[model samples]
Target: MTDDTLEDFYDAIQDLGHPVLTAEELARALDCSQEEADRRLSELAGVGLVGRRDVERDPVVWYPKEWDQQARRERVVTFPNRREFVVSHPEQFTRARLSTFAHLIDTNGSGDALYRIREEDVWGAPYDDLADLLLALRRVTGERHESLEEWITRQWKRARQFVLRTHEDGYTVLEADSESLMGNVARQVLGEDQLHAPISDTESWVREGSEGEIKRLLYDEGYPVRDARDLDTGDPLEIELSLELREYQREWVERFTKQKAGVLVGPPGSGKTVAGMGAMAAVGGETLVLVPSRELAAQWRESLLESTSLSAAEIGEYHGGKKEIRPVTIATYQTAGMERHRRLFDERRWGLIIYDEAHHIPSPVFRRSADLQSKHRLGLSATPVRESDDEVEIFTLIGPPIGTDWSALFEAGYVMEPDVEIRYVPWRNEAAESEYASAVGHERRQVAASNPAKLDEIRRLLEAHAGEKTLIFVDWIDQGEAYAEDLEIPFLSGQTRYAKRERLLSEFRHGTREVLLVSRVGDEGIDLPAATVAIVASGLGGSRRQGSQRAGRTMRPVGGAQVYMLATRGTEEEEFVRDQLRHLQRKGVNVIEADAETA
Candidate 1:
């Protein structure tokens, strides 16, 4: 074969996403005979462009001669029984395809990725047509996985079996695709309080206050109900975004508008808050913004006033310190879920309800607010995973997962992917190791996490990255206080007075403050846009969400970002850092480990 033909053959195999392929597989992909493929491979190998190897199943496997050094093949291994897939060096297209029906679980900095395909992932798939979803699955895996496809088809059907629609008589009704589905699925799962009455064999009257419950129940039963009810879009308030949205942000808004509800899942500094505001402007109705803390509530108000045409009088904070319900109201999850405060929210008709830092929605206290009815629901989170693995509840309550993949945003310059490093520090002294060894249960983990040696490493990192805005995160309040004192920076925790907390965060945002030692309060809610470096001194016990969120503090569009996680050497802290960062690694973020002395 000519050199051009050989190059063409190489390109074709590369497009298949596998660096090595047997003659049979190569023939199928290239539409040539196996003998022809073998002959070509032999010739290519002779030219020092290809290598041939014998494996167990395949007598001969052909790959690029430089595959070991130059090829970053997208290697995908599927496990149907466990519903898991391990993909290494997944290309952009492969990742995009897998994302339609699979949940990314873990990854290493070496490009090995783990994904799980749950019933909810298929049910909440973005594809409107099953054929499209099936095509994507086939494209990603390079073959028809009959068992997986059958399961996905069933889930796709189940997700579409029931629809909550508005009846001409003005009441909400649950409509099923078939009478059998209505009886076997909706009627069987829903109580009389939820399904008020049977209007027809396939339609039933739904109670006013039971819409969220009905959806949740049906979802728990492996059937996702499509919500099409004419929900209340509260008093019309005209709003427009004063700032321009990036292309992906615009796509997110368009998707949310079509679905009327979804959680925006992207990395920090990808402008999910801006996208949430876009959804608000598209809704053109009163919006209720729910946050995990009073700090975020205040930030949301400020962002609205600055990014949108909303005035200070129009946006009100309805948390503990404030109780003003204006056109756009922001409330903390704790206060909004309270019985006394819930009535106020229930009384008003909100056109849009934005859940800021929505990963907390699965917790009992925060879950209650998710039941609030609104015409549009928009959830914003950089890391949506929770320790309980209650991600299903989050999607069911909010909507589907919507947004660009983290890797895509990082590559597109929409968000900066931080260089994450875990520095293993030795114990402060023999006494510290002794104390940790003597402790048991949770105390042991705490002792390891709060190792005093981390303070020296933190100081060194701060000095190396001097003049850059930084955030020091600690899970323990006492450790955070001590670190603050050592570093001579303010320590902001949950116990910090509201006024002081607000002032400190404001200073951090405006660059008046260079560094802040913060406790768990800085994990999710507060936005420190100017932070260029994040030093995580201690983290919650192996909480992947916490790890991702702390690192996210420095993820912005402009400038380089760095995350340094200090782990006590030869302790559980080492394992915790690995477990926590695996999530980011799977999203294509690089993570490296080093000794504190060198770091």
Candidate 2:
């Protein structure tokens, strides 16, 4: 049939519930002559996509049935499985017949075969008819036929796929993962309360170990485990554990131990690492902490040792530079990205896993998180807002959010909040505005960098906050270099040597250096708590996450402090600042617009 006529026929079937359009009806719908409509219907019928069924009483009238049983038979025989049937008749029949029988079993709601069935019923057969079909199939195959035994064995495997017997009169869907599939099933079947009834020991054990291990542990503890795979592999090793958990941190441990996965979002220095350590202590098993950068990984190693009784030998570091996986290993995300290294982590299922700087989780790392059945999972970050959709993946694989409010940390005197100020500078001359405007795209950022108008303003802000520890945040290396050269302050960037970075950070930490200029490297996981003032010379286009990290640098409670963000008026920078402010506002950060005159 012609494409136009076929489209019309399909649309008519959808709208009118059948393709039985008379020539007269088609003529009116298509605005064509009756002869033309009759021609199209003839072509459609010839193609076997539609058929004419004669009415018993009306000799001239007929209805359309899209393809009768003969046409359907031809199509079904041409299917891939049908071709295989013609090539290997008996073997094909065995497999196809078994699959069909399995479907029949499922339709009847037989617990053994229910996993194969998707619909409520097949044809018009009632539940009892399914039982009769099973008996008939068994008789046709014969009691001694190997195919019959194979089919029954396959049914057993399929049955195990759906139902998981946890305890006496307690069951859960076997396919459930980090997000509870059985929990959802229970809500549909038994209502919300029964599904959410404080998770049992078996459920909690399953959250921590593999299904086999959970079954084995339960059987060993005399819980009448039926699954053979649950056989014990012997007692798991006991690892050293020590932690001082706050009330909130201890409560978080209880919830994590029960649920097995969750996130911890709190501002910088709110004890995310410490709380995660406490959860690991509760697990009392080997732990691995993953961080975004090597620096943060090292910082975590130190923090864990300082807060707990873990010895230097107990903790190992894994990153681009180091390669060691101790009982309690601390690894950089970069190392986790390595294929071979990731395999090692997968092979060794740590009891508890912690993600530091959790917002920076990449897609690959998030996928790897799924293969791990860690009994306890803890994601730590001051800003859990991710820059990509991978954030949603992390939320699914890592579990749910569990922690106290960031502002509550401030209220409880756990972390400090800084005073913030925003400064705007307009180009003083026509030549400067033209230069700034002409620098669009990549050059636009450079134009804003070397505006010369903001140099003195940056110096002025530094002068006002002089003698106090200060960090000048810049976007471009050229801008940072120029500022460092003109201001005679130490500078650090990706180009800086490791030794120089160590020295610069040390000098800043001590009282020797009053001012330091840095690029994005210093945005997060750096301990610059001594610095009380931050001058943001360039901003990362509307990224509230970046803004939070930049502002958080000076938020440490070394007495009250201030944050200054410099933006060029009548440029993309203004719109960028507005976008960033929107993100900060959601996090309870209010940005006030001011000028140099106010300072």
Candidate 3:
């Protein structure tokens, strides 16, 4: 009757070949209630002594650890038949690979990799000829890109749902590549024979917004991959400011806990970057924050320094001429995506990586940054929706996207609502209209969008919204210059020096200049929240993504924020705006028609 003898009871049950016992059976034997037996048995299992097995007839079968260990040895040592014998005990496969596998046959323990395959029939063939044999046997299984050794390793891992760490057993294990696992999937979806193309044409289809398509391909192929990631108690992220997350941001953060990597799709000024900072702190590991431009890289460093406990020494910028790596580093996608930069940072283990403006991630260069090892990743984007199907690669390379619509954020009082206006502009040269109508392709669209008449329209709006900051999005550098010179405002293009670009944007953000004209360079990464009024006088090859990105530039929650698009009445420029307006409408941006009376 002494309670001190429970360890003896546990040890006695753990004897090999002992019958499986229930709490009720054990309670009857020990003269105790089933609940008391259950509690004590749980303690034994917690200490790695007692274990459970669900037999065909029994819902829950409790057995000693010895029984579980013996059953596992049976799986590793035995096979379904002589056919699958080549899969595990491949000693007969003279050319077959030895993967510390021979060492696994005798035992199964904490560090051992478990394989559970239930095939009715397996191919018994030589290692070199196994593919053909398997093709004949399974009819569904093919050596699309994997060898017999790898296929068995991967398939067994899928059925077992356990990953094993590598050791110095002196057994060489060949690692698999993306082209092998994903190549077949890509070919099936795109109908393209060459899944891995030349560098010049590598990204023919795997462009942005392809996440959904990639998911379909994975499901169709029955790849059995369930996002090879899991989250745990991350390192405690310490910051200077105490915080309370909004309901939606909390939802995203909680989801991140479920999926170690995911995208947070809140609008600009909805604290997406702040949410990123929160994630960095939550994981409490060395963090890498990737952004699209050097300006964003600098802004991230500044924000962290101001809000987090990270000092200037702790937060480093790896962009442009400055390349510093620290506990918290912010690098431009272009800088970190390069092979040289990758070589420098790839070896370091990052606990968390935050991608700001994550829509840019599917690009060939940006995807390279994903090669670095990181346990947790948070991709932040207003819209992962892109004009190209290439974005299908984002899900595989990063993780699945979790999007909280900008419209929802707007409704929740998290981001500013847009005041959209559709305006019409006459041709800068009326005679050019005849040629533009006759012209085809990108040339005609450019001429129609770059109307010099739009400069006067910008002037009138500047006069109306006198004190409000204005951003004029021209189609090209020369047009931006002509308008900036005529209106006595600043102008920016890709040609602007990095230092000068920074200075010009600083002046605009701080009100040193109320109005500045910039070409497409302003669309992607530059944040001009002070500019409540944006005039879109040019376009980016009818790309709806470019249009939405341009609208996002003025999304910094400034009062009276308005976005106005001016298109030539009858040209393709009008069609482009109409197309972009439809895309924005789907994103819940309000579009209104404007005329002289309204102006």
Candidate 3 regions exceeding 4 Å error are: 1-224, 227-244, 595-599
Instruction: Order the candidates by TM-score, highest first.
Output: 1, 3, 2
Shift in Å, residue 439, candidate 2: 2.4
What lDDT is obtained when candidate 3 is compared to the true structure? 0.62
Tell me the TM-score of each prediction against the true structure: 0.83, 0.60, 0.63
Decoy 3 TM-score against native? 0.63
Candidate 3: deviation at residue 518, Å? Answer: 1.1
lDDT of 3 by residue, 1-599 (tens): 22443554664456433667777667776678888877777787777777876678756667667766564341223233321322221221211121111211121112222222222012111122444444433322222324444555444443222111122442211112344443344344543332223222112222222333433354345442233333222344455545666666665676675567777755567778777777776667788888988888878877787777877888888988688988778898889878777876776667888888887877777876765546787888766666786554554456555545455455456677777788877666657777787788887887777666776787788899898888888877877887877888778999899889999999998988888888888887777767788889887355777777777666764465889989877776666787886656655567887553222
Query: Could you tell me how far off, in angstroms, the CA of residue 221 lies in candidate 2 after the best superposition?
Result: 38
User: Where does the lowest 10-residue lDDT sum fall in candidate 3?
Assistant: 95-104
Give candidate 2's whole-model lDDT: 0.60
Instruction: Show model 1 residue runs off by greater than 4 Å.
Output: 1-98, 105-117, 131-150, 196-203, 540-542
**Candidate 3 RMSD computed on C-alpha atoms after optimal superposition onto the true structure:** 21.3
Measured with C-alpha atoms, the lDDT of residue 525 in candidate 2 is: 65
Q: Report the Cα lDDT for residue 579, model 3.
A: 81
lDDT of candidates 1 onward, in order: 0.85, 0.60, 0.62
